[model samples]
Target: MDSPNSARYSSRRSGETSRRHRWLGGCRDANPDNRSNVRASSQNIMSATLHTRESFDHSPVMAEEIVALFGEVPHGVVIDATLGGAGHTTRLLEAYPWMSVLGIDQDDMAIEHAAALRANSADIAQRLDVQRGRFDSIDTFLAQRNIDSISGALFDLGVSSPQLDMADRGFSYRQDGPLDMRMDTNAQLSAADVVTGYEVQQLTDVLRNNADERFAFRIAKAIVAARPIANTTQLAEIVANAIPAPARRTGGHPAKRTFQAIRIEVNKELDILPRALHDAIRATAPGGRVAVLSYHSGEDRIVKQAFRDAESNPLVQTVASPFQHHQSANKLVRKVKVAERPSAREIELNPRASSARLRVIEKVGS
Candidate 1:
């Protein structure tokens, strides 16, 4: 995979020009051979050398639900753990004028984009503090600031539409770009490393566990056979060809799951998520809320388990005396129900919101 700096240099040498546009750009190409051209055009719109503020434009999924959850909390700081494009954070700040937000994200581009937005809007600038780091280190950030607890926290999990739209970032399977998919540009491991290095079984496990891809083993075998896969388009083509034609026709895209699994592995997303949720619950004030918007079953499952474990002890308490026994507990922010999804209207407007599922929980005792 090419380094970001090199990608930028190459993009300029290729005579590409950046353009302002919304997120509806990259749909799958009908002609497999022309997929490379589609990726090149996307590259032109989001040149690696220049990421215009407009390039980060993304519509927050279930914006009203997020605002409602955080708005009900008493006045205090709110943490936006996955502050991609600051869409949710912006709405959150507007809804709760009395509250402030500490926005955290691993992506440098996201942080830069947020800073640019802050510079333009004085109201947003005054209330939002941007930080570049992973959410799992929330405790460290809080300690540095001498803060004890926050009123609420929001975790919007998975890749954002802007990231997918930017072909150089390589999150999209449909676009032909470098295999690099590190959320944090400074991160050592990349999707390219996983694709080029992982053993067949390891790759299979990643696909099966992270994405629930039914053809994990077959895909892994194909990936191994096509060693040193050059770009997203090539990898996608390989996976598509490896799958049974009938099966490939039904799913939205055959490469979607493989790309998701690779990105998850490269970023260690699932490994860090459990610790991040624990930190959020621990750092939140009593009665404070924690809301998560997950885009896939693997992420949703992790959130569900974390909420369940917080509400009940995994082991039975041996002591008979209730007064003597000590146990931690968590409360549901609202009544427990099936995770919320975007409305048909939202999906119609932004197809990316189709798979989103929102879940909320709260801290119980002090």
Candidate 2:
């Protein structure tokens, strides 16, 4: 879930402006076929923001399926790991009257909005426990409340629509903004640090590892050469020039991959995911589940491996029942993989949902 950047064009790219668009030139592909699926997701997000007493229905990807998955689990508190606007949280609460949500997010804006939403109704306030924190530290949050086990956990990975639409937050290259793509406003590391500070090799790795950009090395070199990038618009221009013109004609935007990579790095989105998923699995009741909606290849890979390991690794322990006891034996888990793009309509309506992959694991034994 990510940002903006700015770097002046290098000598090789100085003259190519006339050949591109008036605004960011080739950066904003004029071809309708090249409209970015991921960026287009913001439109769906905006549409989904229908306000309700339960919470804002932020058009959570696969909300119905998520609710159904939790329906069979032992009814209790479910962790909304990435609680952007409490879309899934409120949905779950409404789905099962007995269900409650432990909502968490690092973004101050999201937390404040939820607080206001809760204040308007005492029911929401009692049913939802909003916390300002990262999902990777789920264990600590649970232990602090003396909570030992959960019914299920849901992680909708990636930046939310609100984060992307706010250009000042620096999650989009479509608008000109400072290089500050931090999910948590308080995080010391920002996109500014990433674009201006990272060395070529490190930047290249970030690009390739985070977004699978084919021109990682070339982009890294171009960015380094055009140092002191000031804003997202400037960064977009540099990235567009770094790639071959032919390639730019096809992708929705030349800077999408780079912006995503930098945002991932600034937030360390992948670093703590494995541990968080494992912890969520460990604390779940035998019949409970951990569901993840990963938006990119890197996140999906981590979720797949963590669940697979829990099923096969005997050393992995789990809570035996409720909050009563724990066991050291193998934690048996059944993996449930949903169909690729199960929601064709969802994808057509919300382009960003196209890349979303849902993975679920139900704990059967310990």
Candidate 3:
């Protein structure tokens, strides 16, 4: 994901190198145990632990369903527009070994990691064409690659586990680190800048718009008072201080909502999501399918709307009807099905995956 414009922060090399090296060392120690666990797990799904030394190996959520959804489509190309740890991409590649994939991501580390992982698997590595870009620019990316049609597409939206677990990324309010939450570190706007720069009204608007945080005004007021907040801990402490003792008793950490709002603002996540979904619909060939995995209300709303638009548009026929009619064009199940939540077993294994919802749509002929 090397970009000429993204290389301006060379001075931060020492810090990044130290952190990545530490991760690589830690990964080596856990490699055998993790690999053995993966092998012992259900079915013959290729899986591995993610690390700086290795390629993106984070496990996919709802992998079986994702692969199944795409498998129902015909042979051709598939696009993974949000190739986060390439978790879903890996699964997609494995399920359709004969199919080619154009995997895209804005994160430089993720792109590098995916490339490395692809190199490790001779079959998948050969079939993959990696690109570094945001999902919103799907059309431009496709044009650049001279790819106009795709059999299917998948977007496993939102942050990856590594981004959250790694303290330096500044995604999690729990980890003590800087407030820089840009998914693409190269982005000039950091979470710290948003927190310290945005006015109370602006901050409140962002919080309310992004996450519907009820205490947005209170949190915004606290943030403005705590100006010049440099790190994650400082911001988290101020947010915590804003919450009343009684309200904090039942709900989770007070800073959780504030941090989420700031991260969404920093990344322009909501703004790009709908456009990405539209581009995916346009790129998909007739009879193709698109699956989206969203973790929040805002993201799911965008997916829901974009899917509805695609299904209703005159250019594409809807596979499934709203009702369970016998003479439906494609099938009711192929229409925007009721969003499915992760199983309790999955939530038990990965608490972060609890809020995840899977949505699938199939495209009929124009």
Candidate 4:
């Protein structure tokens, strides 16, 4: 993967530009991919405006699978842990008119959007509770509200559209925004800090371990030389410039893996995911279900392992029911099902759905 900067000469070639754009377009078809591009194209739009009607046309990943895990609508509260843009929340409210939702997000902007969404819908307005906090603190948040044991919970993990689309968030290398990629803008750490402050080896390890970037060492060397990266475009450019010409075009984007590594580090996303899933499972009542939609291998690994561990406990039993119907409460899905991707039709409509994978577990043994 040639860093965009290193290959600026080649990138300008008509053929190279076309190939890059085509690859980008393929990735963009998924909502997750769109968010990456939105992060890259952040300069033109406000973060709040980044997620307008046009950006939200695609359905969420595995909507039916999630609904099935949730089973027939139960008469209790449910949590949407990540609650990005409230897509899943909207569906839940529609499917189960009686259910109340506690939609939580680390990002204040997401909270704002969810609140507005609820306000616009009379039914959701009455049933929704929006909180601005990390999902890892879900138990504490619920306790504060005098609520315990929700009937269901959902986690749509990873960057939301508006976060990437808005350049100020600095999540995408493609978009030129301040190198600040904090999911919670209030957080002190930012992508700029990583690019400018970390040691070469440290940065290399981050790219290699977190993102599996093959050219981690070279990219790290380039980034160290281009210190004090002020914004997304410059950092991405530096990374792109680092790769040898032969190695540059190997991957779709020379900076894709490096950017992913930096963003994950900036947000502390992987670090907290396992803990959040475990806590979510514990927070729900026995018979309650927790469904997670992960967009990448890193996120899916944590969800898969956590659910697997839960099923091994004597307290948790396997749900033996057929796939389409609801399984008994107190029983979880027996195995980690294949990672489900967006349908071809869905991918066409919302390119961002491509990388999505959904997994679920139900609490048993009261």
Instruction: Tell me how many clashing residue pairs each candidate has.
Output: 0, 11, 2, 20
lDDT of 3 by residue, 1-24 (tens): 111111100111124454333222
Against the true structure, what is each candidate's TM-score?
0.80, 0.80, 0.82, 0.80
Write candidate 2's Cα lDDT for 1-366 as tens digits.
222221111012233332111111111112244233323323322222222312212356666567667877898889999887666665576557677788899988768766755665565677789889999889999999888899989888878765775678888899888999999989999999989999999999999999889999999999999999999999999999999999988767889889989988999998989999989988888778788878778878888788778867543323312222333333332233432333786655445566777777667654
Roughly what TM-score does model 4 have, to 2 decimal places? 0.80
RMSD of 2: 11.3
Alpha carbon deviation, residue 265, candidate 1 (Å):
0.4
Candidate 1 whole-model C-alpha lDDT, 0 to 1: 0.70
Off by over 4 Å in 2: 1-57, 314-340
TM value for model 3: 0.82
Question: Tens-digit lDDT track for model 1 on 301-337?
Answer: 8988887766563321111111122343522222354
- lDDT tens digits by residue: candidate 4, 116-164: 5654455556777999999889888889999867887888877765466
Candidate 1 structure, TM-score to reference: 0.80
Q: For model 4, what is the alpha-carbon lDDT of residue 303?
A: 79
lDDT values for all models: 0.70, 0.70, 0.68, 0.66
The superposed Cα distance between candidate 2 and the true structure at residue 78, in angstroms, equals 0.5
RMSD of model 1 against the true structure: 11.3
